[model samples]
Target chain A: MADLIALDDARDERLRDYTDLRDVQLRTTVEQERGIYIAEGEKVIHRAVAAGHTPKSLLLAPRWLDNLSDVLEATDAPAYVLTEKAIEQVTGFHVHRGALAAMQRPQEREPREVLAAARRVLVAEDLVDHTNIGAIMRNAAALGFDAVLLSPRCADPLYRRSIKVAMGAVFSLPWARLDDWYGAPALLRELGFTTYAMTLADDAVSLEDVEPAERAAVIVGSEGPGLTEHWQREADHRVIIPMAAGIDSLNVAASTAIACWHFSRR
Target chain B: MADLIALDDARDERLRDYTDLRDVQLRTTVEQERGIYIAEGEKVIHRAVAAGHTPKSLLLAPRWLDNLSDVLEATDAPAYVLTEKAIEQVTGFHVHRGALAAMQRPQEREPREVLAAARRVLVAEDLVDHTNIGAIMRNAAALGFDAVLLSPRCADPLYRRSIKVAMGAVFSLPWARLDDWYGAPALLRELGFTTYAMTLADDAVSLEDVEPAERAAVIVGSEGPGLTEHWQREADHRVIIPMAAGIDSLNVAASTAIACWHFSRR
Candidate 1:
């Protein structure tokens, strides 16, 4: 049975997992050190559990405790019940969703292991925005992309903002950080994948013209400064979305979705 | 010639156009009542001017004064130069972009007029996020969509964040609101548009299977609720972006981009 503990004091040390929710820097560091991530709202918390992530603890408002009884019954983790005011005091923000779960990070998978049976993949390079990362994951999962390989500098998809924006799609998508950001292109090539760098260059083939290989990987760049020339040159093919004159490009996340749509057309 | 004025006081009443920018409700009311919208940063401000918007006034940091001299020389609007700190104090946020312009909101065009000659259009229904609206605009512009038609409850594309996120694509792309959000389908039909509501209905045709019309409009819905039943039923065709077994739909912005890319191929 799960331990249902009453949380009367917001300052309790046990509530540290939910404190300073708005402090990105503090939360990121603490989460990384503790090897855990925050899953906010009832739906997202449910998704995290479905993804097989073990919950260290769950912070729930009184009203939410019964609503998530099934979820609580499935886990042995302690559930901390707090008043709305106490949750606000602990999280440093209003608990609008009425529930939050701090989940233990699942073990990392090697890129090769993730790509072993995959056909369509998205490789994100140096993307700094968590929302964009989450959106890409959502699009990738929706459009049948098998896995996401992120450059070392990409934002954490497990972050609360990303999980919220993705509507829990991050939990369903398979993703891993690339150990060698610089060698990403060569590594994909060696793994029997044809890499297409999504870019805007004169010589790039239109998205409609490029053929997806049996095993294909589309490499997406950061929000700004696009893909560095090195990675662009490394890919076997460069494809452009063929925009109208004058307008430069689609938002990175939008581009990811369109690219996935094109690649999955087969 | 634009008049150059020095502004040291952040609390000056004349600087009201640029105050407390983080307060969306307050800013929306003020901008709407003043019959103007803000264009932030050098790039978006330049885009607004290039789109032939009339600038009511320009608030520029001293460092940005020279950078935008060509723009200033082109208008008779007063340019108020403030220190970075004063700009921050006035805007309640760091003016990292360093400039803001209060530009007259362009006169609203009728939906019929915007769609009259357009071969490709994106009809946004009840989209509430400014960033999504902006991204849709950018995608529409980049992918050669001719215009955008928004439902009544859709967010204002002229909002600063939308302008910023769209990278000022809203200035270039033609858009108008459908005063009758519920009657949008009938109006589009009367205007000779073959409407497609992007949905995930089991019987919906795959995007690849649906042929484009001579004049096509793809209708996307809100982030929360997809297209309402009434709008979906009213659409000429309901199309699905075929996905993997268990996955659902893409983000509305992502759906917009993919849909536009599909329509533009014709």
Candidate 2:
């Protein structure tokens, strides 16, 4: 059981981790330097606990502590109980969810190792938006994609906003960054995987037409300049989702979800 | 040709529609009262103009006016050319996109009309997030979904934020609100459409097992508290996208895209 500590002062030193959250640079720098990230809301905190992430401490309103007694019992971290007003004052915003947890960032496994045992994987290239990156991971986790591989330009999945947007699935999903897009396809092929690059080209094969294989990698690119020509040329197959007359393409995240679901079905 | 009206004064009464935009209440009131919306970026502006939306006016930096000669040639509305500094002062933010357009809201078609000629339609119930609403429209347009039907609780599709996030596809896609959910499904059935409701129940049929039909309606609910029990019971088919071991469901927009593509393929 976790120790419950009562905090009356909004400026307590122990609450430094939850302060000045609106400043992106300061928050990200703190995360990188201290190797910790904050997870907000009761649902996400519960997911983090279920995924076996160790919580350094939990900040919650007294009302939430009383309401979420069962959840508090499952974790061994100290709980800092404060008034709703005090909690809001420290966080620089109204966190209506009432409960938050600061947890250590767990080390991730290499992409090759994750792919070695995977049947279906999602490869994201230069997806710079953190929310999109998080949504892709959430969709991948929900649709049975075994893992996600990110190119060098992808946003940090552990960023505060990404974790919040992902609903904590980022903590459970297997992800790693690949430094070299030029050589990554060769490594995937060596691992018995067929690569499919998603594109909007007229000549590209329909996603439904691709035959199921034992292992496959679905490659998605950034929003504007989709998959680069170099990567598309090297892909084992280029697949397109047939669109309506006036529409050109779906958002990258939406397209990725459709492609992932199709791959999962196969 | 659009009359190039160079305005040096930030307080020009003619620019009232584009002033103090950072005020949320004022913007929302204008949206509700005037029923007008703003579209940003050169590409979206071009698409909106091409879609026959009458431009009320165009606000552009002096540097961008030179590049917009072709666009100006097609419209007779006054184009207010301002310096970058003046543009920022008027809009209450840095105007990096260099161009913006104000458009009068076009009249909407009835939901029944949009569905009558459609082979496939998406019914969104109580999805209030503007971004999700926009993304869903973008996906529906791209995946060949014929039209969209929104329940009364859904957000306004013509809202400014939704228009921007949708990349102007909202103007091209056909959509309307359905005041009656119960009667609507029955109407759809009478029209020879198979209604499929997405749910997370264990007994629901896998999406892969849903046979293709000539006419189909895929119903989706808000992020949490998925399809209402009434919708689930009323639907002709309950389809589940097979997920991984521990995950629950995909994001609403992501799931909608997958379902739309599946229906289009069939």
* Model 2 regions lying over 4 Å from their true place: A1-15, A67-90, A179-182, B1-13, B19-26, B70-76, B81-92, B179-182
Which of the numbered candidates is closest to the native, going by highest DockQ? 1
Show pairs that collide, candidate 2: none
Give the per-residue lDDT of model 1 (tens digit) for A72-97: 99989999999999999999989799
What digit string (tens of lDDT, one per residue) describes model 1 on residues B1-266? 79999989999988998999999989878888989999889988888898989999999998998878889999999999899999999999998989999999989999888888999999988888888888899989999999999988888899998988788789888899989888888888888889999987889998988889998989988866788999789999999888777766677788888889989998
Candidate 1 pairs with clashing backbones: none
lDDT of 1: 0.89
- What do the candidate models score in CA lDDT, each in turn? 0.89, 0.85
Give the chain A TM-score for each candidate. Answer: 0.98, 0.91
Name the candidate that leads on TM-score.
Answer: 1
Q: Lowest summed-lDDT stretch of 10 residues in model 2 chain B? A: B28-37
Count clashes in each candidate, considering only residues at least 3 apart in sequence or on different chains.
0, 0
